[model samples]
Target: MHRNLWSGFCLSSLLAVFSTLSGCIDSRGIIPQALRFDDAKLTTDQTIRKADRTVEWPRDQWWQAYGDPQLNAWVELALAGSPDLAMAAARLRQALALAGVAESEHAPQVKLDASVQRKHWPADRYFYGPGVLGDTTGWNNTTALGMNYDLDLWGRLRSDTERALSLAEVAATEERAAALELQNNVVAAYIQLALHHARLDIAEAELKQREQLLELARERLAIGIGTQLEISEAEAPLPEAHRQIDLIEEEIALTRNQLAALAGKGPGEGARLERPKLSLHGEPALPSNLPLELLGRRPDVVARRWQVAAEARGIEVAKADFYPNVNLVAFLGASSTTGDMLNFLTNGSKLTYGIGPTLSLPVFDGGRRRGKLSEATAAYDLAVEQYNQTLVAALKGVSDQLIRLHSLHEQEIFVGHGLETAERRYQLAEEAYRRGLTDYRSVLEAQSQLFDQQFLEQQIHAAHLTAQADLWVELGGGALTDDSGPAAEQLDAHKTTLHLPGRH
Candidate 1:
């Protein structure tokens, strides 16, 4: 009796010590350091200008600014059916479901367990050595209802739920990013298709002109008025023009195939695509002053931010592992001696019930808890660094695109003037050659220079449009301007849909 009293005293002292340690650990909340960045402090080029800040940002459907119904249709198709976007959407749903699972931990869980079985026990069983509870070889039946719930004394469950919610938000943003990517790809492809059409037209016109010049040269040579050298020079550009036609046609066909694939359709669908008539000038006008914080609205940046938040919450969860876990458990059960299991549910049968709390504290674990805490802290730090890098890259992307657009605008002006000058020079050279004031070589050289100038002009025009498309995409396809919660909401609304263009 004295030993039993001493053992009880020792156990009480141990419990008291552990309870004190748990309180101390709980007082030190696991909160990661906060991160912040200034909106106007990022590095920007001198070409950046200030515009009316009051002007509204671009709409989410910014491609509509191009006024091309076909482009709008294609973008809608890609957004709804692109495999990449669908994958991101699926990931987001999975994250949300995981979050729901985490949330369920906050509530009590109850389970009903029922079993019926025949049992054979020796009359000399250890607990009842002489069959004290009646015959030991009869059928045994039991039924129980059990309930268990974590007490969450240290806010661990709350932290876990928050971490899951943050991850779900990250997935939501990624889905938006994927949708934006699909929109950008479709627009760029459509622009390339248009450029191919222009190239083909230019090649055909140049080839026709070359054929006329070749005929004129052959006629002059036959009449002994032109040298064989002149005929050979005229023949030189004709084959190149023909080759350009073939090459451009091949590119157009390939581009259409790419668009069809992007829209999640068969290659034959590409053959039905018409030449795009997109006007690129002054469409989707840019805001005057772009604050650095605006880039934070980008889906990728937002996703990275959520990643940091989730990792920060993870640290709290890991730190909670160092403290005691408390649980409330209860069970109500009945046993039946006969083969009829339903007898256990009757009031007359032997009944048993238990209700109590369980507490567990880690005294030793080979430093596993400390290691987990360290890992969580390190992961949080990594997430912060990654978020910083993503922000920097986003700023650079915006600056680079701004510089490119400005340079293209300047180039277009000069190329336009050069094209006009070359056209006039070619006209003068042709008239001079017809009157025999200049050699046929002069006319051929002038005409070749004119063709080169025209091609350059066409190329410049195409590049300007493509640059605009690039800028549109770099700006997140105007996703930042929308107040929608996430692209996941859009995906959910279209869960049962194959074509979602009309739905939006």
Candidate 2:
């Protein structure tokens, strides 16, 4: 009867312990309200023209749309070598490692401990004063294996791990954003360098023409057909032309150095690089309708969305802290005070072991737990606000690019006509002066007017190219694919399972 009773007690104790560990408080009911935004309000723009509707989706290799091999090569180099990209990748790795740490917390943790020490105990120092232990001196050795498992009875560990997982996703999106930014910057710098190159060519050509006119003026004056004032006026353009050339050269040098840095190389690295002749086939095509789904393709938006999810998980973690914490701990060990230290390893040595579950309940925390929960909720609110702000900014960015492109295209037509008229007038003035039908001043005025128009055309062309680049960047640097559909929609499928307040 006693044997049966002992067996029943052991079985009952095991069942009780297992039952305690298996129970988890339901905290999902208290999850904050869903996050919402009007899709039409975010994507609807009054500035999109009908022409923009005749567009297609952006390509993954959008830079290739410019049709410049050198430009494509440079961008690839930057992507491969840029230090900014390297750092972003490192951050992603770190976040993933931290996520691993959070996961490890949910698993059983085991530790081994061992110690050996030589000690002399004098019983005389205690109640006996002279030789209580009988000069007890020996080597004490101990070894133990301990195991612990925290019973997540409130989903605290799960919530913590979810937060970490979301953070890792955030890091990955941030890296993508960094890469997009780097590519855009490199393209812009290359465009500027090409503009300066065109400027230099124009300046040199103008200087040669101006020098020819100066010679003619000097010849006319010597023959008493031209005044010294006409000669001086013609001479003035030569120095201006030289100055323009000097400035353009300096700008080209600076731009090359900038590109080199973007490529993660020394300044001198740009010296051997050739000038880029990047030209666009046409303005990049755009999707007829931009939905909120497409807008989420922007890395910044995705990262922020992930951040909001992570913060929401943080709220769950804080709430879990208000509940009781239970942990199962077990230890097995042997200790021996014999002169032979290895005796601890023998089964004959004294043994000590313990195994049990521990429970802790908060009684008087002075509102610390409540304060933390409040803080987490506030953080979630901040993340949601930031996400909204980013969405608005992204929409505005696309609209701004569209407006600028439209204005530049309209101006291009007018600038082209102006350039042609100025060229004709300069030709007429030069011919008249050669035949002694007009003064040198008329020729100088015509030359200056023509130079201004030519420079204006180059500036406008560069602006057009840059506007195209900005548009591509706003469209997520062509990172989206048809398979992915829209980034927001893709995130939605996963977001549905998350405890965040946001709704697609």
Candidate 3:
């Protein structure tokens, strides 16, 4: 008994030594090199200094701030019906299922196996001994229950589960990003429709003015005070003005179709849409902690950050692969080749059972383990770089939108003043022409100037509205917040160089 006890101790010590030596693959050089971006370090103080920083972040339904009920309804419809969003949602569900699969790996597994057969042995004198039972048929049956449970001494299963969960988070954020994009598209199309309506109004007004000018020219000619040149010039502008009206009306119809498509409906549905009365009370404002908060606000950035986290977990899984894997395996069953069909279960001699621990050590595999580790580390670095790139692009998008909004605001002021002066000049020119104090050319030139300024004013106004929409989109469309899943900073906090068991 003492010798047996010593033999068991020696076996355990040998196993321990073998396990320690099995992890000899050089994993010290396989480490990720890419670094996560620090949101606080990305300076944006001077860029948005003039922006109103007192307003809160945009709400979930940010489009409602435009104060247009029709816009609100359309946005809601798009959210419910958009196929792009549906696809994104499906991807998220698939990711969640995969995560569940990974988690299941950490749990113990049990299986039942059973088989039954009737066998016949031929009575050949040379193949069987004299006393052997031959030329007989018997029932052969077996039934067993087996179980396996991993010890998880290396945390391989845990890291794999974590990676899958992080990928699920990435999918969730992508879904949010898709939803936000749909909303932006719907609003953008509606804004274009509104601008088209405004332009149509201007075109119709110009056509009316041209008709009145032509009538005035005819009256002057009948009173022997105007030349044929005046009538010809007035008629020429009338045709062009009508054509402008037609073009604007066509644009309006096309824009309506675009809005319907964005809502995942037919063109006819969009045709029923009334002119949008979109308006905002004040200029869009930024938050005081724009740069620092943007990491959590932008869905794309959040998704990328989650991807990095998943890859980091992948590195852990790979590192765990270099260690030994231990599993507890057990089975209980009965088998019989004689007696009744149920003899296997009733006879004590047929009983069979086993329970033991199994160990799998990676001795050598032609550098397969090292290759996997290198691959994992490379994947982690790639994800980190992608996250960093996304963050940079997000910041640039915000700054670009803000700059456009500011420029549009300043241009709107100038265009308003120019429009007022043009309207006054056109009125004076018409009055002088009717009194025979100026020629028809002066009236035509003044009308041209007034129309150009009117178009310019409308253009600036439309730009301001579109730029505001873009800013909201660049600001993440309010799809993320404190209540959202893990933030980029939180994910980055877990980022570190992975080391093997004994590597310094």
What's the lDDT for all of these models? 0.74, 0.80, 0.80
Candidate 3 global lDDT: 0.80
Off by over 4 Å in 1: 1-15, 20-36, 50-56, 123-128, 132-136, 222-224, 227-229, 281-293, 338-342, 482-504
Q: Give the TM-score of candidate 1.
A: 0.85
**Could you tell me how far off, in angstroms, the CA of residue 126 lies in candidate 2 after the best superposition?**
7.3
Q: Top model by TM-score, which number? A: 3
Which rank order by TM-score, best down to worst? 3, 2, 1
Question: Which has the better TM-score: candidate 2, or candidate 3?
Answer: 3
Per-prediction tally of clashes: 1, 3, 0
Error of 1 at 396 (Å): 1.3
- Name the better of 1 and 2 by lDDT: 2
Candidate 3, residue 145: how far the Cα is off, in Å:
1.5
What is residue 69's positional error in candidate 3, in angstroms?
A: 0.5
Candidate 2 global CA lDDT score: 0.80
1-504: candidate 1 lDDT, tens digit per residue: 999999999989988999776554432433455454554676555544421121234567877766679999988988877888888989999999999999999999999998887777655557657754445566578889999999999899999999999999999999998887788788888878877777676677677767887887788778877788888888887777777889999999999999999998889988988978676324233343354534657888889889989998998898888888989999999888864546777875798999999889876676677677777877888888788888778767766776776677687678768877888888899778666687777887877777677767667666766666666666666765554222221111101101111111
> Judged by lDDT relative to the true structure, which candidate is superior, 2 or 3?
3
Query: What are the TM-scores, per candidate, against the unseen true structure?
Result: 0.85, 0.86, 0.89
Best by the lDDT measure: 3
1 against 2, candidate with superior TM-score = 2
Query: How well does candidate 2 score on lDDT at residue 502?
Result: 14
